[model samples]
Target: MNSLKTVWAIAWRRFSENSAIAAEMNGRFIATVFYCTVLVPFGILSALFMDPLRIKGKPPRWLQREPVPTDMDSARRQG
Candidate 1:
């Protein structure tokens, strides 16, 4: 059908004209982006949620919320 040819042409154009597509057609960039977005976060969250059962060493400290030192006037007030 004529529609098939037109669709193929559009697909070819998409493949050719896009600079990103021109870089890597073997899908490495896409896989890298997907791994960065999905697997890295998943790994981080998994490690955070799971307890270290003393199979190796002490568990690392979790991040704690702390107040910033906004009292810079302490030195001036003292002097």
Candidate 2:
């Protein structure tokens, strides 16, 4: 579309005007693309396969944490 092209052209002009900032922005854009295309899908597949609720293996230590007391009395006692 013409609007899209115009937007891209403006962006390119700005990018060309600031080489150092453009390089940093380009790195961030690549990182975002990589995360969206690769890391996020991989994480989803890992979570699906390693269903935390199913517990096929020894669960992580964090999951075994004892509940902390939340009442005011318990907090006062601790303090």
**Shift of residue 56 alpha carbon in model 2, Å:** 2.8
- Per-residue lDDT value at 56 in model 2: 68
Off by more than 4 A, model 2: 1-17, 51-79
The Cα error of candidate 1 at residue 34, in Å, is 0.8
Q: What is the C-alpha lDDT of each candidate?
A: 0.80, 0.89
TM-score of each: 0.34, 0.43
Model 1 lDDT per residue over 1-79, tens place: 9999999999988877796665666488788999999999999998988766755466778898885556878656765
* Tens digits of lDDT, candidate 2, 10-42: 999988889878889999999999999999999
Off by over 4 Å in 1: 1-26, 52-79
